[model samples]
Target: MLKLKYYLSLIVWNLFVNTLGKSMFTPQSIRFLLYKMAGMRTASANIRSGCSFRGKNLVIEQGVFLNHNVFIDSWEKVLIQENTAIAFDVLICTSSHKIGGPFKRVGDSDRKPIVIGQGCWIGARATILPGVTIGDGCIIAAGSVVNKDCKAHTLYAGVPAKEIRPLENREVNANIK
Candidate 1:
């Protein structure tokens, strides 16, 4: 009965709040309230309309912004720290199927935490896979696939997201304030 109620409410939220574009006009406080009701741990974050998140293991810190159409599949914990901005159409997933085993044959899956440190920017259409820890002040370029841990104050781009360069202290500090 509890599972049924939870799923029903989640469906209602998707239909009324996420798909109906309510966040575009709804006050930020109301939006945060709705998300909190849906079991997300959110601070003073701004989540734009058309964004969708699943599970109760999601945390959005103060000043975090999730742009339009962002999808978070939080099978495990997903933590977005303060002052981070995730651009449109980004996908952050914390679950994936196992490979080459009996469990894989039976469609078994694994989950891990995704932690995005403070003051980072995840560009549009970037995909963050399970168990990825993105350090503070990093920039992930658009269309990148991040499958591993990232360093602090770095710029990462391309498929599978190679480190482009270490961001200068000036560049890193500029967006912090």
Candidate 2:
């Protein structure tokens, strides 16, 4: 079947990437080409070494930067728009488990897409859960856990990633160190 073939090819490609592709000698353009060849939607974004992915449902737009050790489990589609910068050790997953009855805490698997709008900055160690659509010009602070949608032009930082405040361009420069 087509699905079987698709999965098999993806597996092989993942294996190849996880090994030799992570080497510094491997060019990022070659990685992008390999992903595209395997039917994944990707652009000329700079994906650093040690980054891992799952499935073919991924879209990395132009000017996006993914730092080292970023993990993307794309059970469903994950679209990172242009000019977005994802810091190191960020985990973006498209698969989760539903809460079930008392006997069985974790129920069936739930897969949903994640859309990161243009010009967003995801800070280091942030964990973006399934079905999260981050709006444009947003900043996710370090070590935050994003479990819901984020609004545009805002700063979010917390355990559950509450919106700290709306971002406004200020004209004052001060150094208080």
**Highest TM-score against the true fold, candidate:** 2
Which one wins on lDDT?
A: 2
RMSD of each: 3.2, 4.0
**Local distance difference test, each candidate:** 0.86, 0.87
Query: Residue 6 deviation, candidate 1, in Å?
Result: 4.8
Segments in model 1 whose C-alpha atoms lie over 4 Å from true places: 1-27, 100-106, 170-177
The lDDT of model 2 is 0.87
| TM-score of model 2 vs. true structure | 0.86
Candidate 2 lDDT tens digits, 1-177: 999997897677876666555666678887666656656677744888888877768888999999988999998999999989999999999999999999999999999999999889999999999999999989999999999999988899999999999986442345545
Q: Compute each candidate's TM-score over C-alphas.
A: 0.84, 0.86
Q: After superposition, how far is residue 12 of candidate 2 from its true place, in Å?
A: 2.2
